[model samples]
Target chain A: MKRVVILDPLWPLEESADVIATLDVTLDKAAEAVGDDVVAVLAAPEQRVPADLLDRAPNVRLVGTCSTGYDNLPVPELQAQGVTCIHVAGYCDDEVAEHTITLASALLRGVHQLDRFTREGGWWPFPREPRRIRGSRLGIVGFGRIGRLVAAQGNVLGMDVVAYDEYVDEATMRDLGVEKVDIDTLFETSDVVTLHAPLLPETRNLVNARRLAQMRDDAYLVNCARGPLVDHAALGDALIHGAIAGAAIDVYPVEPPPADEPAFGWPNLMVQPHSAWYSPAASLAPYTRQIDDLARFLRGETPVGVIPGGS
Target chain B: MRVICTDDTWPIDRAQATLDRVGATVEFAYEVPAGEDIVGLLTYPGCAIDASILERVPNLKVVATCSGGIDHLDVAGLAERGVACCNIRNFCDQEVADHTMALIYACLRGVVMLDGLVRSGSWWPYPQPPRVVRGARLGVVGFGAIGHLLVQNALGAGMEVLVVSQHAGADEIAAAGATKATLDEALSTSDVVSLITSVTDATRGMISTRELALMRSDAYLVNTARAALIDHEALGQALEAGEIAGCALDALPIEPAPPEEPARAWTNTILQPHAAFYSEASEARSFDNPAEDVARALAGEQPLGLLQPVS
Candidate 1:
């Protein structure tokens, strides 16, 4: 039987274990899968497969991951070892995109406050504040699958959808009917801003104090892409100082944020622990897709989802 | 009796204070993680409450739902076991109605995506997407409290409104500034269809494949009610095939949808995790209003919002 190693402990162990004769392991348990030249390795966002596992599994021709972010994988090592990496990227594109929109709308409409008062039930003796979305400006940071999807939904909300993706040409953006815009103009004009770009060296701390200072006084900011994409300290300070109206965040630089984190202390900030991609429907796609790719790879067929060689 | 609050504060505190005024012991657990049991359960929508949970607390006399919908609890099971079920349904009509319009505007304008792009430094070079909300047909599928609120908001936005509900008359709907139409007519002519109806046998699956087919290709739908009101597969198909422009679903057939459903990956859809009614005012209402019902129930007087006995 062909051995398949799964590096993520939290992957759908029940369904995937049945898909193939497999060696299921956490990142630490990965050594067991390497014996006798395992055919493939399946991974997820949190798992980091070491070089030893790659070297030991000599027959491992494919490294399949259940995540769009393959940064956790040792890509250079895999390339050097002649191993191809395939990822179930963009599987949660819509979920994340949808979440980004939800957070943006919430911030614009003062949802955290609304949630607070609604929980009290007329006890606060204060009239509720009201806001509408018809006149706001929405700026999208990345125009990938999720960004494009958010753009389509945003059009239905009646706000302008301005987007800036460095890799997307003006013509491509126009084709999607999204207006290509400059970063500064977007912040100054937008009533709300949401992030969907990949977290890369260039994008780290992308939403620093200088960029946030350009946003409208009542504008909202959201980051569902990656926590490092925004300077958390700057964002928390912005919320406290009212530099921006509010923020909704799902991803954090640190998971299970330490109890004393500034994000928890920010008055207008709403935080959801890195759970945007965890809807019941979105969670299974990555694992199932990884399994399918492994099945194909084991059959000596090139898996369809392999990331382009250069990427 | 002492009560422990969950992650929410405003409503629970108000209710706790009210109970305190009446000389009942109250203990608020400001942030109870999901699945942990407090001696008394002060519930909120999207918070986990189930039948098996009753086994853990022998002194539990009531399950107070802080929102209009009590489907989160096993009502029949609770009633049969002599546990009282109380829900606050009418307190946040205007607030929720306002949110429905907010979603309409958010979806139409691409507000969420644009906001993210600008603040992330990507908008410095891109143009904003075109957006319009005025003059569009706003269809209200359920002309209840929240629906009525949405009708007024839509009219204020300078849009023609359409109201479709089981109990609405032409004269009453016209008075609300919306033309009365059959569900099919509402689906077809609407630029935006908002659902605010209760989920029932007649209303369940109200918007299925046939109804969605009647919608204009560029039209959108918004639901702030139970997810069972619409057929999920039909909505997914409508979005994927571009049969309907898009949808904003605050509630889903299943909460925290299991990962793997293709719907999670669907583009052009907005999911809100069922929080439209959760303003601070609404939460306070949900908490205190339920107490009123409880007080009445305990007094041997018929409680407001008592579950209707099935025929």
Candidate 2:
């Protein structure tokens, strides 16, 4: 039997047994793959699959990561050797959009800060008075799949939804009930601005001091995308100086931010531990989708999750 | 003619703009002084109006309250004295609906709990795993204007909605894209349940020990309505025993919650300072509508917001 190694210890391999029952593959959990018998290796977002994996398991023809972001996977080298590189995508589109809306709602309604305030023996003239969600302007920073979903959800809630994306045209956004605006207009006028852009060299630190300064003092920010999308120091300073009202972030500049995280001290800020893409239904979807794609690839079928085999 | 405004926070300028048409002037006062010149009395939720107030303002033609609820007004007794008892309605329906939905999203997504978890320097093993919002069940406990708006919001978000209302028929609920359910069914089946009902003899203490026991262990309860709708002691027990996962309360038995409030120490609860029905627009409407109704009564036209019109 061919071997399939899983790099995540808690991957629950047994749950995917039915999906791979037809293939003569034995699943094993390990830090790394080895031996000529190994045909495939899978990993979670946190577990890195090194580029030299082909050196140990030369016959390994497939590699997959159970997440949308393949940052931890060394894609270029593995693809050079003709390995099928795959990562789950669109698996949690609804989840991330929902979580983004939740964060935006929390920031607008002052859910987090007020909870702490009430606990610490304070009351109204609520240090941060809750605002109306309906009619409040919602500025979406990226108008991709997830951004469109957020715009739809925000529209249903009666929020005035607008978006900014250089790649997407105004008519497309307007068709989705979203107004197209420039990045400066988004930051300056929105009651809450959310980011849904992919991380790249040009997109990194997209929300720097300049963008933060352009935002209205009563406005809020929400980021569930990559951590580096916003300058972490600028976010903390915005909250510290009351330049903006509040923010809710699910992803951090560092995964599981180190102890003594400066974010803990930022007033009027809500921190989440990179869990925006999670839900009971979504937790197993990425893995199962990846495993099914691997099974498909082994059977000479074009798999859905294959990342293009080039840099 | 003079309109006496007893609430210090009332926007007299806006009210004067309305009272202008009826040739009535508005004045602020700590109490309604015994004066025949007082043709209208504008009060807020905090100020109670009984027949005894008639002895102070003998010429009062209308007693108007800047709130939807008329619990503080002796409507019948005041109407017997040829005084119209007017209270604003439908002024903050959108605000309440938006706030309730925000709390619902906050509860299901576990943003507040996760924020606390990250701040405590703990990551990964989420204290409570965030759940998916789309396809998650939402139980709405009332079917008034606010409740209807809330169902629209939830249904728009792709949530399966189960509405419990004594007055709404299944056809009506289904017409609104929701299924009708009994209170017990809603409590047991919903992932997040919101209470938006008024307090009445039949509804008071409606969610007590027996009702709390029927809730799912993972369900979240949201109360943006009157605190009397729930039994505080039973709710505290349900949360501590983990019978119910958590609750988000925007109202409490006491306003300006004292330091000893028990809900403060309850597990996985979010508290707000009874701030659900507020927004710059909604606030303006609440005050302006009541002031306009008072002006209407003084002008010999029928007042729009009268709980009991003078015979």
Candidate 3:
């Protein structure tokens, strides 16, 4: 029997007929379960696998990560150690897309503020400033699966969607009926801009001061991608100086950004604690897919979405 | 002159008493009073008041409305025949603003869809998805009174707010503690962009396909402004292509949807019967001045809610 070690902390698993979990895995509960015959290691993209973690689990033959982005994995080392690697991609695309819409709509409609005002005992009665969304342009910064999904949803709501991706050609955009504008035009014309590109060497800080400066005065920025795509300090300055209108950030430079941090002081910024990825329904997708993939892999059947490279 | 008040309709009786206190004979109408000269029209939408009925009043000098919108009236032709027109535009600001928020929330939260799903026995196990509103960016396309109210409401919800109004100034927005962006900026970055501005030549079809392409694909749009502000076909294409997440429309380029229109079949979009500003409180406010304005104008006083000459 294969002994598998699970590392992601957010989900709870019931002891199943075939698989047993490494129970109570935490920093304080460390070193309690160095099983002698570990065959598989389960983890998430954000987590750092224990050092000597591979060697510590002597019988471990594979590492299965819960994310497509495998930046944390030392691929060459794992391959040299004779370990197979697995990654799950496109699992929570719709879920994250829906969440993106929810946040975006809430931002536009002033749902939080209105609900808060209503809950605060009529401190602010009377809608003081109402705006309309009709006749507005919507720009998307990336055109990946999730980005495309978001655009599709926006289209359903009667918005014009323009998209830009360095790698995607105009023909592809034309097929999608998307305007293939450069980054500067996108920044200048869009009333709402959302980030969806992956964090890569070429894509980091894509929304820098210069790009931010190109956006219209009343524009808003939303970041659900990695935080490195935006310079937080520059964003704060932009909001403070009224360079752009306001911003809603679901990802951050640092997770659980310090509670006492002064960066929270920017009046025109909205920050969610880096949690745009998981909704209850979406959380189940990858888990179920993982279980099914595991079952298929163990049965010597080809599993869907198995990353091609070994280790 | 004897004025008739319908059952439970506008407190025309109270208005009548006010009129009679100042010396005018008023009668309650279970039906349109026989042989009565009903000069001013105070009818609701979908009510029957044909042009032939107007010919009954030989001494009719003015037509007044007990509503903000005057779609029920033939204003142009009536004015051509020299009938002075009046309506009620104030007093419903808060109620209309509240209605706008309600539509916005309903669209963003998928309230209607989730409710239907749960009631139809497909509960999906989880209660409808939980969406976060805090720390999102809001773009208000029009900075009129209602738009400004929404901005304040968005702020109270902990959302970053921006205003896109050609009429407004940076100092005015800054004083309101909001960032002022141009319409272009507001469209691109707003997670949601709502319309609350009056429709004018400069504003008609403002959100063209070119502009819509500027918005982020994940964004949602809410429009409580005039329908002509957006290009509906462009919106339909955008929605079909997923250029935007979803939309909630309070106005249609064509009212009553003509039964054979494509808009009637759209499921993801939310379409109100264009009664967003017709709440109970709004109705009362609508009744206050217009009814009196017509009565006063009949008695030769200044009309309330009167429009200035269309310069």
Candidate 4:
């Protein structure tokens, strides 16, 4: 029987046990159980499956991450060792997309500020003037699955959707009914700009001071993708000086932003932990897909959802 | 002609500009003096224009309101004094619709609560699964302009739209791709129920304890219309008892909700300061329309939004 190692406690082990059974495998959550008998490792995005950890499981040929992002896994190193690394992508597209819209809508409509007012027992009819989402321009920084879904929803809300993605062709954008624009124009023209790009070396600090300065004074910024894409100091400063109207951030440069983080207390800023991709339906999709991939690997068919080397 | 504007919150410059175009002089004063030559009286939604106030402005020919609803003004009293009362009805339809969707999204996705968790240094993923807007049933309580726009957007986002309205015909609701539902059916079957109906003798306190009891335990309620349409005390009790999940309210029975408001203690509630119809675009329209109506009233032409007192 094949021995499978599960490193993440949050993994839906019981739900996917039947699939593992079909592969004639015995699953163990103990990392120490990873030995010669282990052929696969099931992990989460936050779990670090480094080279040393992989070295212990020499017989392991497949590493399946039950998440769309594989930044925690060293893909190039795994490829060099002839190990297949797969991640579930496109599982939480709708969830993340809806989250992005929610952030933008909340910021524009002043939901967070108003909520605070109500909680403080402040008088009703506080002088908060909010901008409407309809007839406003929505700028999507990435044109991937999640970005496309946000754009489609923005169109449904009667917003003029514009996007910036170097890799997406103009024809495809037109087909999706989204206007293609350069990054600077998108930042300048959009009333609400959202980031959906992956965190990469080249993409780090993409929303720097210069780009932020180009945004409309009344515009809002929302980040639900990865936090490193935005400069924390610049965002804080911009919000402080009222360079922009407001912001709603779901991801942070550092998880559990330090207690002293100034942005946490900003009246104009709405902060959320990295919980955008979390919905009952979305949380289940990835684990189920990863289990199916593992079953396919055991069948000697090339495992699907393999991350290309250097990506 | 001289016009007396009683609301200081109304845009003075915009109203003045429109009045100038039509060759009318305007004076803005929060207090209306007795025996003034005020040919036109400008009032806001929450401001009272009773018989006493009318008697003060004995020469008042028209009462133009910078709001959609004329509930604050005694329409019968105005008609008895031979005064034309006009309101800006459709100017903020899109704004209210946008705000309604924002509240719905905030409540369903637990955006406000999740933000609080992150701010308090709770970075772990929230254990409770968030509700998704995509396939859920959305019950809209009214089918006015705002309700129609909300229905279109909700349907576009893949939600099943259900509407209950006394004024809208079955064909009109069906043409909008929504099914007609009675108030009980809407409350019982919907995952999210939004109140968009105007407050009236028949509709006031429509969602009290009995009506709330019919809703699902996990469902949410959003109100961007009148606060009198819901019983706040009952809503607070329902939330405390877990009879319903949560609510997002833009209107309260009392503006500047007193510090002792019961709903203020409920964490499941999101309250805004009656700001649903506020947006830069809508604010501009609110001022411009009332000024034009004043101009038309002076010119002996019919005002666009003239209101006739019920016989």
Looking at candidate 3 chain B, the ten consecutive residues that score lowest on lDDT are B115-124
User: DockQ (Cα-based) per candidate?
Assistant: 0.04, 0.77, 0.05, 0.70
Per-candidate total of colliding backbone pairs = 74, 0, 67, 2
Give a tens-digit lDDT track for model 3, residues B101-138.
55554554454444333334332233444343445677
Which pairs clash in model 4? A124-B256, A124-B257
What RMSD, rounded to one decimal, does every model reach? 17.9, 2.9, 17.2, 2.6
Interface RMSD of each: 12.3, 0.9, 13.1, 1.7
TM-scores for all predictions: 0.54, 0.91, 0.52, 0.93
In order, candidate lDDTs are: 0.69, 0.88, 0.64, 0.84
Best TM-score among the predictions, by candidate number? 4
Error of 2 at B137 (Å): 2.8
lDDT (10s digit) by residue, model 3, range A1-311: 54566676553454232442322222211222267666666676666565466656776666666765565566556766776667778866765565565555544544434332322332222232223343356688999898887776666444577889888888887676577788888999987888888776788888899988999887888887778889888898898998987777766666545554445677555555444565555556665566556656666666674655664
Q: Is candidate 1 or candidate 3 better by TM-score?
A: 1
- lDDT tens string, model 4, B1-311? 67888877677777788778667778878787765667888888767786667667778888899888777878888788888889888999988988889888888888988877777777776843567889999999999888999998799878899999998888999999999999999999999999988877899899999999999999999998888888888898899999998898887777667777677778678878777888877777888888889988888899997888875
Compose the digit string of candidate 1's lDDT tens values, residues B164-211: 878989999888778998888888888888988887778989888999
Off by over 4 Å in 4: A31-34, A121-128, A256-262, B12-31, B36-38, B52-58, B125-128
TM-score of 1: 0.54
**Is 1 or 4 the stronger prediction by TM-score?**
4
